[model samples]
Target: KKKKKKPRGSGGGDPGCPRVSKPSDDLQTSRKSGFFSALPLRASLRGYGFCMAALFLFCFGSLFYQLNGGAPQILQDIRHYLGKKFSLPRALPFPSQVVYNRVGKCGSRTVVILLRLLAEKHQFNLVSSDIHNKTRLTKHEQVDLMKNISKIPQPFLYTRHVHFLNFTRFRINQPVYINIIRDPINRFLSNYFFRRFGDWRGEQNHLIRTPGMKDDERYLDINVCILENYPECSNPRVFYIIPYFCGQHPQCREPGVWALERAKQNVLENYLLVGILEELEDVLLMLERLLPHYFSGVLDIYKSPEYKKVGNLTGTVRKHTPTLEALQVLYHRMRYEYDFYNFIRDQFHLTKKKIGLKSASQPPAYSSAFLRELTLRTPKPLDEDEELESDLEDKWLLWCPS
Candidate 1:
């Protein structure tokens, strides 16, 4: 058959020879190859879509974060991460030294109670002085006291009924200072009643505390005390709150513009915070925020059932609200105090706002004429002479043990 054509896979070729594919087989092979080849492209397309979606979400999230003022926080966190990752490590000083030259009758005892629990839990030193009688000290005494305070181990909180002690003035490292104050009239009233009847400690406790008190003096009507201008209810006594901030200057004990201004300046410069006792919860919240080392969880402690029971047990024995006329007189007498109180309240609200807490209202911005108005309100012509400390009983000397 001459060189007749043989089948590709069979014939006179070697038995091991490979077969050549037919057109139909080629078509099937091409289809399989095409299907396998399309898999990679399809996978790549899915990956690309996924990346695009992720990018879109990232961009949207960034925009939303920026709108919510979270961009700076993100940037800060990134910077912090980078700094920690790449920078040479350096020890940062923790704020460990704190001073609470606590004002008397300003819920300090309650704070102390909470502090006692916190100190036990947090393992920090809490030095609460038992001495309540002396707030002012001689230069020598101040130096001695500052030395003593500085010698306390680090991470310590020293609290006492004392005026502001300028450690820097004596070349000692100044500790962070915090304080709480009450409405001046309210403070006066509290002190006034506390001296006479004591707290829930019982009347016998009061008798032992004030052995020299005459029945008339002890039972004196509060209205008479304010209206009749009793020495205890007047100037230097009402002048009380400012001196706790105004330092140990003898003049600080007097109620005058100088003392008031000095107290304000000191508060601005030295105090980390000057809270109002009326907003005690807010005060504690701020404390927790500003001094987490010492005051963390303090609010919870204050709200605990055990703490509430203690508070009730230690409440003022007899609190009398003065007659409206007496209250008005007391208010006028405490005008400077009211001014300081208003300032502290405004500052407190501003701080609250900064910390993302709601305030009933923002304080009005003071105008340039504030000084003139302040002077007019003081009315120096009406200011009487503040009596000597010895002339009146010092009700601030009262301290109920916790």
Candidate 2:
């Protein structure tokens, strides 16, 4: 028999996974607080066998990435280079340092809620800053925050609306990244006219208190604003997907050829999962599979009552005021975003197929029963990490020497 490996930090699992204690299913109390506190002595023959298996799977993810091709230009569209990119066949996890760089108006709140639920359910620490309505965290503040997390006893999930940037500068364990993007057109519309409009609308807000509101007209004022100064409007406010994904830099917002390419490449390298807002169900299912260790029981929570109540408020359109014509005209002014949207849509479909899921672009019809199953609520505060004990055993056994 082989031996076992020690976790680099406390509460760690497997060999190179997160160092925090495995999150118990219920956050109210730890189911196995001392489960991995004692490091198994690997000097024995049996311990060595266990160590080899654990280490192989731990590094298998990197090998898979190298074999699966890389970010390259194709047909002048870099999106094709991201072939089967978002889906991970083998990957490692370091949960405490995981960061969800939430982009604004990208249905990011739903992702945050899901992360919060996972943190609470697993009993992992969640270092969510109460900071709200901001685009980026100050570099010094980010550095200090990461430093503080190292002193804490549990793993953490940092979820907030922040643009992507090099976190290594903060001198921390490089965080595993995950985020979702939206059809730029829809995201633009959502940001353009949702919430705080004519007091929940059938009417319009006369003041147009929105920042960067150049002209406070009664109608689609941004339309006119674009015609007068296209670059100023499109570059700053409307064309945001590239800037958000590309990380914080002046060149990122250049609205040039290199800018788009850099954003695509950054996504390919940094983010483990880059899901689309349109194929949300597939994304959630994908999360459970890819990070099964961390998101084990998350799949069942979708149908629970507390999950639904939390989900519905953010899932559906809270209100709407834009017309089809408004979107059509807006599209004309935002051709770059249109290109970005189409590329990501194709990427999502291709990724689903590579991972053995039905093509998201052409999903089959769901029965009424299945449709209702999606909304039937279950009690809140999700269950324990039942998969941990079994998963640990099953994974090692697969590689045990015969």
Instruction: Give the per-residue Cα lDDT of candidate 1 at 364.
Output: 30
Task: Write down the TM-score for model 2.
Answer: 0.56
How many residue pairs clash in model 1?
0
| TM-score for each model | 0.69, 0.56
Q: lDDT, candidate 1, residue 129?
A: 81
lDDT of 1 by residue, 24-82 (tens): 99999999999999999999999999999999999999767533433344564676578
Task: Give Cα-based local distance difference scores for all models.
Answer: 0.77, 0.56
Please give the lDDT score for candidate 2. 0.56
- Error (Å) of candidate 2 at residue 82 is 44
TM-score top scorer: 1
Task: List pairs with backbone clashes in candidate 1.
Answer: none
- Reference-based TM-score, model 1: 0.69
